[model samples]
Target chain A: MVKKLRNYIGGSWVDSTATNFTPVVNPATCELLAECPDSPRADVDKAVKAAQEAYEEWRRTPVLSRAQYMYRFKNLLEERFEDLVEVVVKENGKTRDEARGEVRRGIESVDYAVSVPTVMRGYKVEDISSGIDETAERQPMGVFAAITPFNFPMMVPLWFLPTAITCGNTYIVKPSPQTPLSMELVYELLDELDLPEGVVNLVLGGKEASLAVMEHPGIVGVSFVGSTPVAKIVYETCAKHGKRVQAQGGAKNYIAVMPDANMEASVANIMGSAYGCAGQRCLAGSVVVAVGDAYEPLKNELVKRASGLRVGYGLSETTQMGTVISASAKERIESMIQMGVEEGAQPLLDGRGVKVEGFENGTFVGPTILDGVTPEMKVAREEIFGPVLSIMHVPDFDTAVEVINKSRYGNAASLFTSTGKYAREFKYRVNAGNIGINVGVAAATASFPFGGQKESFFGDLHGQGPDAIEFFTDRKILIERWL
Target chain B: MPSLNTFGAILTYAIEMESRLRDYYQAAGSEERARETDKRRSNLERVRRENVTEIKLEPIEGLDEADYALNLDDASAAGQQAAESTAARFYTDTAPKINVREVQRALERCAKQHAENASK
Candidate 1:
């Protein structure tokens, strides 16, 4: 049976009232996975109302109790870890192992939020004026909404929900219309957790739902993760509504290979970072600035490794990379590759027109490596968000850093070096939020703040860890004295 | 089979472990180092207090203190992290055997929290 996916609002599985629906496709086989509701503004209203109605009771529930619900949710997630991973693989088209990593990251967010008792703890100070006592407390900021992108339907919602809900704020999630089935399962599990009705709600759609979420008066805050253009829209709209927002934008993350770096390790890490998840992540190392003596050898090794990747269906054990999200995504990535070729960048290997066995209709884009890529090339500047690596050569570490710092995106930057001095200098000087000394994808763990700098991230506080607590709640101070 | 212990015994052991961690972080916090390290030590102290509060909720009962030993191998930041990790795993192992559902979950939550903090 084709699953009739619908919104989960006000403690019930509610169908979208709109007549039109979007077809959810399995990118691996170009198969129709499910029918996601093309949710309208009214659908957003219902979800937001549910969340706003549930906020008072949810916020009044003891923090420990809120954490207990998260524990239950986490247990459910672990018990069905493989099943959810399959959902991601089928719906989002990432390799099984990659899907597993994404699910683990989602689960890890729940695990971290289960520490809300500590994460949300406040402060006390006494004897300011011979008996004056002062205390500060953190309280939930009411209903919040998250607009998750298609590439990471499971992981991105988790990046917001677990933290927001555990901090005693109710949430409304608008999962990407193209990939809503996975979140359907997430809400199904949440249904069994006995949380207060409307504490967690789901609205499935694209722009309309997202815009409604941003403009809704009940939504005190908004969290979003997607491409830079939409992120800016959400940020601006939320700001106009006088709501708190954290919008994580796009990236052209760079990986610098220093002369002193180990060639073998750098090649391996770069291949994984650039090709893993079909290079559809904001933290993917799309550009490699190979400095001085490292350029030739590094390019050769990178090409060799990029050519060796096994591309097939995500469920296949031998498949190292999977399909992009949709047919349009495939076209977009391929067009970027062609643009690189036209711009005079040497095509080390072109992934365009690649076909996979058994899944002839699958949206596949094989690994592409472009050499002699200049910073002025559109492929080098924009986020291709695919299995494409652009290699640029520079004379020294300073030149490489200079080239990287010139880019508008500051999501992540990495340095591969054996010299501690050079590594430390690069880390300190890199104009990115997440930095890596010898790491490729310098993604922050659940326990640390994960965000970008400048255009990459808007707002002061980032998501995850202590920053999540700050984002979900507001701090209030009190002064009292007794006669 | 490993020796069985009461809820009080485990709680006491966890409290002792947190005390050792607190001492280690406090010493590290006082040392002249990078400002980031100072922030880390302060965060560790907060985690220590949180662990103590959760464990304190369990009822006291008869379980020998001799089986538990509080020791800190090192008083550095790395050492404190190791202690927190050990404590996290201890709670994870103890949770299933904990007869009360609420207490079991509390312990599990602490375990996951410390494990998270250890990585950070």
Candidate 2:
């Protein structure tokens, strides 16, 4: 018998009112894992109410005090980083190393959030107006909600919630149903910090629970990371309800390889960005637009490197790629490969029939590559969200720019080139939110704002960096007049 | 109150629509030997269409499918076929033998759905 999962609400674990329960399956062996509470409207209401109630005191907590709590949370995360990584690997089907990377990234977010006292500092101007003193600062948005996707359960939530909480606002999180256990553990750690009751809450469900939170009047703002369509719904619905929203959506991230670029370095970067976590990351580079004659050499190198990647359970140290989130994900990746083939793209390395001998039931798709892919092919246009790479050959830099520009998702784009001119032009020409010259993964650090343009993101900005502190807290301008 | 009621109704309808579509796909996939599965799938699709239309009628517009599709016909066809086959395998056999084409089509459908939904 599997242990039943419970929701963390108002500072304690509680049984869900919903009768329907979803079994958390291990993507490794298709084993019956733990069961998570299927949250309903009633549960959402309870969590929201708790968060609302806690916000009053939480927002009033001094900045230094809030910073203290964040430091404690960061310490807790670091101390138990290995444990969290294990849970992520087991529940989310990412490699142990990749899970560790997520843990590190999540901790980094927390660390950044801990610096809220400085990041949230106000700017002051003296005598801007005659005999008037002016100042501007950020304040908490009361009770907020974060709806994070399964790809990076731990890291993505920390991207928003830590800053939200550190800025003295209560939060309710709706983690992905597919990978709820790791988040539940994080919630438990939060509870250990002895924060105010209802300061942080967790509601686990598919769509209904998310809808309830988004529709709730108590939630003043919502920060979401998921597919574009769902992000739009969250953004529009929350906006309609008069809530501030920062919803980051899907990406068809491009990595343009210049003819003069180093093939080995480009291939290495592409390997990590495209195949890491089985290419489930929102920032994962799905499309590689090769310039001029770089296509053949880059394609051969990518295929060779991708083929050598080991696919298995995340716990295995030797495993380079792990099982996908579910069997459905494996099927989806395979279909995209088929589409690539049907669309007349050449398959250099096919991962469709890959089966790990010992773990036959695991949702594992080996690394795959398609050559001579065009912008029209499904593999090139769509976000496969798996360990599959689509290579599009462009005759020149202009064609590469056109191809990257034509993509609907403008989340992140990278250019691997030795020439400064090509890098500068690509940087200026590409329509993505995050850009990289030689770097494959252009994810912004804590200092820079992270978000995309076009259909890749909804709402105004992204979570983390400067934008996160801004998102968690509202800006207020104070003016004084003397007659 | 009207807005709240409309929102509630839309939520219920969306959930119901998702469930029905899932069930229909599952049934169609499972009843591989039976010819009625196709009709069942079609009925479920009709319900999905109606539900989408009804939900969109609310003052607050829900997500549009146009925002999510790369190539609607190809993605949907591939997804539907994959769902049908997976359902068939799940119901009829204990073995986990899956057709590569069916799995691939299903994968494309899923990714397209993600892409479409994310775009919205």
Candidate 3:
């Protein structure tokens, strides 16, 4: 009951010419939802060329006119918000609540784009030195493409697309082959806006399609969100081709808790940070560092609450946790959990053998917590990206921050503490891009830049806010001294 | 009690409550129920869209979905009274417990409506 998904290029849904296609299976029921066409390099070329053709006219269009499209798109999204959220739930395996949250974030980005005319304003000075004037205007770069990850099919691409297009750059989006339908649905909405034919194009595929976007000379910039390893390759490839690139990679975020933290609130937030979205997000708190006097109580409460979470299909009303993205993802996550156990970390709750009655074949992994984890273990340092939390006990906050800072990834870290001194110190000392004080996930909203440091991010600017405006446009300065 | 350990979980329960009420009203088939069905349906969409931000991840304590369960199976006038009373009690009991100001206010308004219905 599944048909081959098509690529939306040149304002219409066109079938990919590739001979091969990738299977997209629902993680909850193991049903084939659709077959994603493994679009070849040629599709990417066509998309970029189309975008290039559109950019010439789109760039000349007034910024206010661009903002109008975003406003209408925002209204359209709100009108059909539930339908989009349902698509996210079915395709991405996020619970309805989580999918709603994702759409909220995505729409918030579109909402932000509506204010682009104000945010993208340039600077002008009447006189710099002796009757000289200076003005700097933000001009849209040509064609840009975003290669988004599967975990957030709607939100992640929306993070870049609205701003990129509103800033006057024609765009091509290559969604993860695993979950391209949500973006395809979004593209339908974009097509309804009826801008120029190629203003925003969607190309679906795997690595070859991505490589084409990177290697294509017409594409001025590239935006990527995925694994750190692949992000590095994208960065290097874009560099060799002299294109601006922003590549957000994997994370192993930590949430350090102090003894004085409100235990009830701390435990609840920790459950969300570690287990929400089944721990697939880049900002997900994968490690909990318990400081002196907080170890026993925090560990006990986290395990108790996590074990109580109801795991089922995303569509289930009361389901608190859902399956990982795919069977292979489930396998990888379980193997990582096993690896942690082999490395001498204690598994307090093993989710491996859990099964739902109707969805016996569902790739479900119940919430799992591993204790006695040290800083040296691979599970402690690596990105597990599953509903797995590793606990490490430290004597004090300094040691906790030390353990967190030693990691190669610096995406996010949070401190749950009642002490103002500890909170301030943690904020000052932590190397992560996002820091949380008495909070769980340090994720940034659309109004602010979603940041990453060290190996976690590879770019001059970030995904949202003013960083996105800068990323999509170049500043052109004019100095005049008219006699 | 069914645990609702975060604002997200609480909001999810709220959405289920409204959607169920809408369905129940549609099944009742009275003119009032039919009118109430649209109100409940609008409330469901409002709660779903207006809320559900990433900020809802903050912890919620001491709320349970079981406390708000509607006894819609009972079809008599007495059962209707009981359902209204239960809905009133849920909104009254949990309104202040919600820390988000807008959601708390919404629950209070819902409580007032249910309480008025229960009295009638």
Candidate 4:
């Protein structure tokens, strides 16, 4: 049976205003899985209106009450976690394990949002001046919008919306058109918590829908995650419109393999960072900068590990890697691979034309590796957003740091080394927003703020952690005099 | 006669404007999602204004309406295709080209940076 696609507006599922329908395709089989309503301008308006109306009461809800709702939402997410993972894997084309990880990360955000009552508490000072007292409090920012990307459809939205709603702000989410179902399911889960109608809404559209959100006066703030180009646009437009904005963009994350680093551990970490989810993640380590003479060894190890990866449908229990999101991604990654080859980087492992058994119709790109990549190459500079890892050799630690710092993106970078001093120095010197030593993936926990720097992120509010609550809320200082 | 610097500046400005236009559309859509009631009218207005502005700002001369519309449509379709293709390829193939855990760790680093910034 085909699943019906609906927009969640004011806590209710409604059909699209337009007759047009977008078929949800399984990337693995190139088969139609379901259909989604092509959310028209009218549908977007209805959802937005519902959220605005709900905001009147939702914004007034007691912090403690909001906290209660968040707790319920968290429980609901956990309850539906397995189903959610399935949907994510099927629709998003991520491996089942990766889908589960995304869902778990999303649930963690909701769990953190549930603690808003404690996190949102204000600070009070007895006296600043004679007979004067001051107190500071956090307040909801009316209505807020979240523009999430296709990657981590569930987790990225939760990274912002949960905190926004829990902090007493109504939320409107424009999930990526590529993976709208996963987010729509999340909306349904949120609805079961019985939060006020219109407090949370989901609109599925493309640029037209996103522009509407940025231009609308009712939206007090906007949070977004996507490529750098789009993030820049979101940031500039919202800022120009006087709305608080946080838009994360692209990344060309680097993993610097130091001389003393354990070859096996580093290879394993690099394999996961570069190939997991086929490198669709915003924080994927696209560039591997090897310090000293470790480049050749690390490259060999990475290739060996890459070759051993079991690629299949995300639902396959034995599969370690899954297909890329769609057919076009395969083309792009292939093109980038071609570009890398043309740019003089030696192809260690060519993933192009890789065919999976039984899933021949699936959109699959093999894990690819390029060696002797220079900093000037497009493969090294641009965000490939694929499972193609480029290895650039650097003579010394300073050179590695320089190359990393020189990139336009500053999302994340890592160093695999045993020396504490070298690790500390690399962490301090790297221009990346996130840094790690011996660890490949450096994503922050729920308690830590998450964002990037330079072209990688375009706004003030980073998603999750303590900053998330603050992003969803505004600060108000109160002054009083008692004679 | 535009100098090299002037031409470069103009190119940069055009790129920036194109980015801003895309963002504005996204933000407007986000607004519609949040507000819901005035979605169609606002979206139409925003799209219309952006189209007009984009056309007016076009550096090429004598581009007709049909051509412009076709170009815009092509661009949009291309973007959608790109997104879908990228997603599809990543999900199907199993020759592990990149590592998932490492990517997560890298994302975590960004999260940590934000946390540190907040404390300050």
Candidate 5:
């Protein structure tokens, strides 16, 4: 019997008032792992009240003392790193290496938070006027909330929670119902901190609970990561309520391949970019624009190499590609591939027919490459969020950039080329927020902001690095002097 | 015999070996060798983390875990000697099969570490 998970409120695990519960299933094994409550509006209110009460004291704690908790937590996380990796694999269906990378990156966020005392320093300057001075200090707001996505359940929340708390803001997290177990484990670690109750809280639920948090007036800011349409809703809702918002949305990234690009290195990078994390990442390269004569051989090598990818359950060391999040995701990805085929694109390597030996019930999608894809096709324009790669041909480097910039999403764009002229030009004029030259996964580190432009992101500040500090705190200015 | 079908599987086997051998040396009298084993494990973990940044999807065909598997139940000096030789052979055998340049270099260094231990 799978136990239903609870909401951690006021430093205790309390059962939600919700009558509805969503099943948290392992995407690789199709096992019902746990039941996540569909928390009610009242439950969200209860969490807000707890966070608000804690914020009164946490905001007053010395900034250096607040950062001490972050460093200790980072050490605790390292000591138990592999255990968290196991939970991530069982809950999120990432392979051991992928789970390790996710957990490590999440820990890196805590590492970034450790610099709160330094980065959160106030700026003061002596004025030109006699005996006068001006000062600006970054101070924490009240309660903040994060509504994270299912694809990166653990990493995304860490990107917000640690940074927010280290800046002395109390936090409430509504982790996706599909993958709440990882955060539950994290909250268990946070519980050992011996801090005051309600400094950091967890609420597990579906849409109702998320909506409640978004609508709550007590929350000073709401950090969200999900689809574009829903991101717009979060942006509008937070704006209407006059709360600070950072809503990261969906993406359709393109990687242009010049004929002079290193075939061996480019193929390796392209494979990792298009298929890593089973192509669920926002920075995933979904479209390949091969310039002129680079199309045929690149297509052949991509098909041959991608066809050889070992697909199975994540725990298997031999398995390279894991499953999509759930059965519905697998179905949606297959239907998207079929739609591409119906629209005149050829299915060069179909993943729908691929299967693992023991995981017959798993939601697996192998490396899918769609050839002869056009710019206007649904597969080329839309975010499939699966292990599907669409290949298209362009006339030259200029045409490739035009095709890439025309997309509605501007999350990330990469160019595979040896020519400095094209690389420099592509980086300068690309519409995306992150540009990659001779690289595929152009993700920024925890010390840098990771968000998008255009329709891909809806706010000013992003989720990681200095942007997080800037997002959670506001600068107060002082202009006075006593002679 | 553990099946070593890919580079990930091979690294997993190596990690398991490091832990067992480190435990064996710590329980017996060789504290210095145990520390070396622990350091090697940490290095291999670093490799594991780096390799995942871009997983090499190519299947490794020829390596066998049976060629390097050790019987650590014995608690004598000969057992330690055999374990060191096995570790050396595991790295020497697996280095050529590695596709990634960093992994190959790390494996070479590991082989040298164990070879020095076996000689002493």
Candidate 6:
């Protein structure tokens, strides 16, 4: 039986006004796991109204009380933690360990939000003038909304929700219609807390629901994570609506392998980063700029490891790489591979038309490695968002940096080397927001903001850490003179 | 609950156990189980308050603050179950050796409650 999911609004499960429902499929087996409401603008308006009504008291609620809710919610999350991992695998098509890792990343955000009192503490100054005092308070913005992507249904929503709610702001989350079922389960966990009605809400739909969130007068801020095209629209719409906005877009992360680096470890890290989550994440390594003499050896080793990766269903404990999100996603990735081949990029390992033994209906895509890729190749420029790694060889470090800086994206970049001076230079000179010396993913922990630069990010303040508190609130200064 | 030789030590450990159980129940899903757990938590709170009052009224001899030190481990389900089981065993082993009649009765009842809750 395909389960039917409802939107959570005003502390209740609400059916959508739209008669049509969208089927949510498990990517691993292409099975319809549930049917999420193709919620219309009316549903969005109702949810926004509920959030607006709840905002008055929620914003006035003591910060400590809000923090207490996060604490309790965190406890509840940890108690049923395995269930979340299961959901991620069942719907998001990530391997078991990868799903667990995503859950841990989400928990880190909650853990950071638990320090709300300390993280959100405002500044105070005395004696600006004789017998004068000034204070600044970090106050909540009325209501906030988040539009997340399909790749990380569990972790990405948390990047916005806990911090926004902990800052005393009511919130509405519109998860990707592709992976809407997990957020429904998450709402059940939040409902267990002692929060007021409509403090947190979920609306499930596609573009119309997103348009509703962006245009809703009650929503004062917007946070989005998705493709660059959609993120640009979200940012522009939020700006037009006169709301605070943070729209983190897609990425084409690159890894530079130096000659002095550890080849074995670098190859292993490249394979994992390129194929992990089936390259669905924004931080997945899509390009590798092997410097000088390292190109031949690195390319050979990478192809060997990429070809050996086990591709099957995410639920299998032995499966190293899972399926792409959907059949369309698989088709898009294969077409991109064909584009690269036609564009003169050497296909060292072609994964086209690959099929698992029994799961023929699955949206599976094996890892593909392309060599002799150039900076001008379409495959190197655009984000394929699949298990395809393009290798572009450079003469030296300077040439590598030059080639990497040519791309329009500046999301994340990494270097594999043993030299301190070179690593320091790369760190200082890289144009990306997140950097790694010997790390593969370069994913920020909860203590720091996870964001990008240039076209990769659309706003000033990012999602996690202290930046989240700033993004969700405004500071008000108070000046007093005693008579 | 080891041979602490003081009513204050017993009360301190018992109070910690009750607090953990309360948190566990607050996160519980079933309405019936939640209500039952809430009642048990209230009973333990009342026992804690009575013991605290007694401690203030008549100071226990040979009592040290160090005896009540706590070691909070991981709060996962298995960890919490182990904690409850350990507390039940502590009360069961220490109740018979207590010289005070009221403290002995409280310890025995607390043991029975923890064991029952843990069995669920």
- Give the number of the best model, judged by DockQ: 3
Name the better of 3 and 5 by DockQ: 3
Worst 10 residues of 3 chain A by lDDT: A314-323
* Candidate 6, number of clashes: 0
DockQ, computed on Cα atoms, for candidate 4: 0.01
Question: DockQ scores for all the models shown?
Answer: 0.02, 0.01, 0.43, 0.01, 0.37, 0.02
Clashing pairs in 5: none
TM-score of each: 0.80, 0.79, 0.95, 0.79, 0.94, 0.80
Q: B1-120 in candidate 5: lDDT tens per residue?
A: 235766668887888899898999889977988898889888887686556443344445566787887988887777777888889999998988877789899889999998887787
Question: Can you write out model 6's per-residue Cα lDDT over A126-235, one digit (the tens) per residue?
Answer: 98999899999998988899999999999899998999998988999999999997798889999989589999999999988999999988899999999999999999
Candidate 5: tens digits of C-alpha lDDT, residues A1-483 = 889999999899899988999999988888899999999999889889999999989989998898899988988787787788778888878676677778878888998998988998889899747889999999999999999998888789999999999899999999999999999999999998977898888988988988888899999999999999999999999989999999999999999999999987788778878987889989889999999999998999899888878788888877777889988888999999999999999989999967788888888999999999999999999999999999999999989999999999999999998999999999999999889998888888789999599999999999898899999999999889896
Predicted complex 6: CAPRI docking category: incorrect
Q: Which tens-of-lDDT digit does each residue in A368-410 have in candidate 4?
A: 9999899999999999898899999999988999999999999
Candidate 3: residue A28 lDDT (0-100): 93
Task: Give lDDT tens digits, candidate 2, residues A1-483.
Answer: 788888899999999887877878989978777877678989999998999888888888898898898889988887686688789999889876577667777877887987889989989898987899998988887888888899888888888888888898998899988889889889989999999999999998878898988899888898889998888898899999999998888999999998899997678777878887888887788889988899889988888778766677777655668888998888888988998999999888998878887898899888888888988887888889998888888899998999999999999999999999998898888999989887777777655678698888998867778888777788899998778
Alpha-carbon deviation at A181 in model 6, angstroms: 1.3
- Global lDDT scores for all candidate models: 0.82, 0.76, 0.88, 0.74, 0.88, 0.81
Q: Score residue A434 of candidate 5 by CA lDDT.
A: 89
**Candidate 3: which docking quality band?**
acceptable
Per-residue lDDT of candidate 4, residues B35-98 (tens digit): 3213423432223212211001111111122211112232353443442232223222211221
Greater-TM-score candidate between 4 and 5 = 5
Against the true structure, what is model 2's DockQ?
A: 0.01
Error of 6 at A429 (Å): 1.2
DockQ measured for candidate 5: 0.37
Residue B54 lDDT, candidate 3, scale 0-100:
59
- Residue-pair clashes per prediction, in order, are 0, 13, 0, 84, 0, 0
